[model samples]
Target: MAELAHIIPASTNGPRATEGADLTESERADPTNILVLCPTCHTMIDKGYSQYPAGELRRWKERSRRARAVAFGTPQFTSRAEARAAVEPLLGANRTVFQLYGPLDDVFDDTRADQWGRHVVDTVIPNNRTLLQLLQSNRDLLTDGEKATVDIFAIHMKQLEERHLEGNWTPGSMRFPDAMNVILKGDG
Candidate 1:
């Protein structure tokens, strides 16, 4: 599991605690100063602070941020058609996975349930996140209704992530917005 590791140790009472002594309190608490590392990596970095200095850790964080931006960044599209083109592939992928292994009535068997869980984690969740990013970034192409649909979709996405990633099951979470299918298409 991923653990939040402070780039410059959060506390000053334990191992490598003194590492962030130079940073202000706000900087120490900042998201930029945290690394989402696996438990083993977190332990290694915490125990070997000299080997993983604050500057080096900060560089790693920055590199990761840049890499994610390149991999998932949405480009500006001039028209609704262009935005639709950019969004369709991810939507199709998500639909395919949902059709094959989603929590449908016919897929209630144990094996299918297992596959559904795995696909939700490995495919559905990531696709939804990327789709959300694309829609939000290309909001200029959306109609008023599409924007409203997106706001609801955002809630569904958050609950889905929390249910799967954070293991926080919330009842009565909003369903996927069907209107999202035509987002940035036709009229509002």
Candidate 2:
């Protein structure tokens, strides 16, 4: 599992103990000053602060960010067909998972709930995130109505993630938008 480690320790007496007297609260809390490391690496860094200084940790963080951006950055397309091609696989995966394990009016049970939670984390959430990024990147191809639908879908995505990840069940969370079915298709 990954854990967030501060490049500069949050407290003066934290791992890499130093009085960050010159840094503002926001700077200390900034995402740039954080590193997502495995438990082993986190412990190694914390215990060997002299060997891995703040500047070195910041370099590692920047390298990680750049690598992720290169690997997963959203691609912009000039046409709807290209956008659809990019998004279709993720949509189909999400749909198949939902059909197989999603809550139903009278079919939900403990087993189905367990399957649903697993699929939501393993498949649905990632697909939703990628779908949203693709749609947002290809927004130029969408009509005003389609754009509105995308806006609602974004809100629905957030609520869904919050419900699963943070255990914050929000009543009346928006349902998935039907228009998403034809988002990058000519019909939309």
Q: Which candidate is the best by lDDT?
A: 2
Q: Against the true structure, whose TM-score is highest?
A: 2
lDDT of 1 by residue, 114-135 (tens): 8878888999899898888878
User: In model 2, how large is the Cα lDDT of residue 69?
Assistant: 59
lDDT of 2: 0.83
lDDT of 1 at 35: 90
Clashing pairs in 1: none
Clashing pairs in 2: none
lDDT of 2 by residue, 39-126 (tens): 9999999998889988788788766765675388977666788788888888889889889888888875999889999999889999
How far out, in Å, is residue 106 in model 2? 2.6
Q: Candidate 2: where are CA atoms >4 Å away?
A: 1-72
Off by over 4 Å in 1: 1-72
Per-residue error for 94 in candidate 2, Å, reads 0.5
Give the whole-model CA lDDT for all candidates, comma-separated. 0.80, 0.83
